[model samples]
Target: MLIKSSKQVSRWRTPKRFPVSRNSGASPASRIEPGVSWPEPEGATRVQRFKVYRHDPESGKNPRIDTYAIDRDKCGPMLLDALIKIKNEIDPTLTFRRSCREGVCGSCAMNIDGTNWLACIRSLDEISEPSTVYPLNNMDVIKDLVGDQTHVLAQYQSITPWLRSKTPAPAGHERLQSPEERKRLDGDYECILCFCCTAGCPSHWWNGDRFLGPAILLQAHRWLVDSRDEATGERLDELEDPFKLYRCHTILNCTRTCPKGLNPGKKIAEIKLMIQQRRS
Candidate 1:
């Protein structure tokens, strides 16, 4: 898709500092991996306090943290599990969106203690201090932990997330390609569209209402790489606008915040390369 030029450029590209690495230059605790499970904190039988942000839009009330106390032992599970236990046993009004607790649905993405994570995937033991949970940054919060997904859904719709073809199929089975061809969009096809990338993005923070963020760019690139996609030119044209593609300054927030390890920054870069190669 071509981005229209009438859109204004944003100054969200300013640099900022990140926290120091805690594991001798290794990845952070919030990193996601299959078959990895988090244990309880080192030593604590006492109560654990959780500070979760609350939002009630109907009353025009400002968002604030509401505290909850749970037995530290039972809370050692995944944060999602703990939150569910707390709500079922303590307060039902504590609100958040989640499904497919196995981390596939991408509904549980949130800012936990200043980082984005799918609560079902993050172990409570990994959090070192009293923690705070909030909706993803820079999005309209619909409730305590649910941000408005309208922009995100619109971007997905913009890409037409399914396969499209302009030619009629042959008289046999569909066209086939080598394994290598299928791998062209390997990691990108796994995207769950959780908005973690956009949430971490400073550009999205400033231009979310206008620009299509990394997540959208990644999806665009995914289709661009698909061997079966028929409208590559049309897709590239849609992204030509300033807010649609050029807004990305390679800040890498989308890469860092993704719970599924999908690199939207890398995808955008690849899309740029494809665009350049097509021009050449």
Candidate 2:
């Protein structure tokens, strides 16, 4: 959920400086330690443990997992609720992105329990063990759970995601599509651009600078299949590069890790087939 107060938003925007620890040189696992233990409220039962990644680049200390004990009885059911509790009551310095707690915003995507997930929608009850939360893998961490998305956002813009048509609208009316034509956009249009699939893909981990990855590729295909769009040839030309579209090896990690359950692997394959068909 978005920070409710302007003051809270200001506090979240400013990264608090943490004192550098003597164990800065120790490995992250070796430095695993418990943080402040909030006292349970009266009648509160069932404490939940969270091993959260903490890092403040301005502090000059290495990243470490700080364990926090949360009173589940006092917290909400979702994992994001625990995080909010931690920030509000336990430690304000702890940082993460969240908005539209309903999971539509896609701002709360992070690495949870060795997989990328939207923390706002994932339930705390779903985690049987002490939950581990970290920034999305293979991206520069902005602070703690926030990953620098400059490259990914740039790649998304590179594809020109919006529809393009040479034909003008008839009599000032909007472009129209048949029901069957609109049905073609079902799976593709559901993508919220969370980048979970991209972060989970081994190919993106290795060649993210060039591959465009599954999330962006899926968006490209979304436009490619839009009946109202008329730039299919130009979109295909932009995605025809070896590293751009051919890097996907059908590993299906993108499909497996997608929080939205859309099949990026299949969309990517369709792009390749279209390229080949055009060449032939």
Candidate 3:
């Protein structure tokens, strides 16, 4: 929704003022600051390679990896910094999902060095040369580095993550619970829904549709254990299917891949235990 007037577009196309840096002869187009040039003479000293996955589903073609050589010194410490730099300086066609520039948004989840991580949180200095990045594994690619999250999101929606009950709340009163009851939400609510846990799980890769997967199951457990939620039995009943609850084979990938350190395996195990206790 860029509603730029014709005048503004013309002005941008033909800038009256061409600010030039005293050092690098950089024009306004590549100015890093008011008068500083991007890739400052001393800034870009070494080369860092990036192998990014590229594919647009709109075009009928096989996906391929594209390599970019970046000036290591020109990039900021984080991996997202290097990506943004590459997009700005080398190739605008390169694309990936990013927002908030912080880990909380959960929008920038992708593989770095063959492991899932939010690019904003992984420091560029920590990784070696020829860093490889890709979208979450085995998912539909809408474009370069962007996966179609429609299916995973739809699965998340199926769980009814919010509290629901046939009973009505008292008028003008809030549902209250003890601090201990609130503690149960700690690990589960902390999940950013980045899909790292589910995407990394071999079991989920095989039984995704039937299993509900770790990310979905983790949030399901969150609502199921809420003190004010009266639908515990209903939630448990829904998750009792063998395929949905038992597909997890404990390869520990879910626990291993979580950037937030959440153990979806543990959460799924609790769900199973809860169901077992109910039956007994």
Q: Which 10-residue span in candidate 2 carries the lowest summed lDDT? A: 5-14
- Candidate number of the best TM-score: 2
Candidate 3 accuracy as lDDT: 0.77
Give the alpha carbon lDDT tens digit for every residue of 1-280 in model 1. Answer: 3322211112232222256542233234222122211233445576566777777677565565667767767654888987897778777877899999988999998987776778898877665346667788777777778888887889779878777888787677986767998999887889898887788788987888777898888888888889888888888888887888988999886776778877788889988887898888
Off by over 4 Å in 2: 1-45
Q: Encode model 2's per-residue lDDT on 48-164: one tens digit a residue.
A: 888888878787766767778788888999999999998998789999988899878888999877678889988887764476787887788778898899999999999998989
Clashing pairs in 1: 1-235, 1-237, 1-238, 1-239, 2-237, 2-238, 2-239, 3-238, 3-241
- Residue 267 lDDT (model 2): 95
Q: List model 3 lDDT by residue over 1-280, tens digit each.
A: 3423211112122232236432254333322222111232345568777877777556555566677777776678888998898888877877899997878888888977766788898877756567777789757678878888898899898888888877788789888889999999999999999998788777877778787889999999999989989999888888888787889777777776777778898899899899889878
* Rank by lDDT (best first): 2, 3, 1
Question: Candidate 2: deviation at residue 256, Å?
Answer: 1.4
Q: Report the lDDT of model 3 for residue 116.
A: 79
Q: Candidate 3: minimum summed lDDT over ten consecutive residues — where?
A: 5-14
lDDT of each: 0.75, 0.82, 0.77
Worst 10 residues of 1 by lDDT: 2-11
Measured against the true structure, the TM-scores of the candidates, in listed sequence, are 0.81, 0.84, 0.82
How well does candidate 1 match the true structure in TM-score terms? 0.81
